[model samples]
Target: MTGSGTRRLGLSRVGAALARGWRAVSWYVKELVGENDYERYVTHLRRHHPETRPMSRREFERAKLDRMDTDPQARCC
Candidate 1:
């Protein structure tokens, strides 16, 4: 209702919007860099192959690299 109160409310709203935008950008960057791939793979294994043991980070990265080496489609132009 007061001038200072209104200014504070506007600032809070702007802060919240900035925070959400920052989070979106962060997620995009993570995906772009393959940072979330391991987490996704682990989730998939848990969902579809619960009996199988999930690969460790090193093993998973090695396996991914091997597959890319063997698969031509994985190579960039």
Candidate 2:
């Protein structure tokens, strides 16, 4: 109702909006760069193959690169 109160509310709303926008941007960048691949793979393994262990991040990246190199169709040119 008061001027200072209105300013505080406006600033809080702007801060929340900025936080949400930052999260969205961070998620998009991680997805675009395949940074979430290991997490996704682990989730899939837990859901589909609970008995198996998922590969380490380093191993997974190395294998992915190898696959891309050996199989032309694995990666976009």
> Number of clashing pairs, model 1?
0
Model 1 CA deviation exceeding 4 Å by range: none
lDDT of 1: 0.94
RMSD of model 2 against the true structure:
1.1
How many pairs collide in each candidate, listed in order?
A: 0, 0
lDDT tens digits by residue: candidate 1, 1-77: 79999999999999999999999999999998788999999999999999999999999999988988899798574
Candidate 2's C-alpha runs over 4 A off are none
lDDT of every predicted structure (CA atoms): 0.94, 0.94
Clashing residue pairs for model 2: none
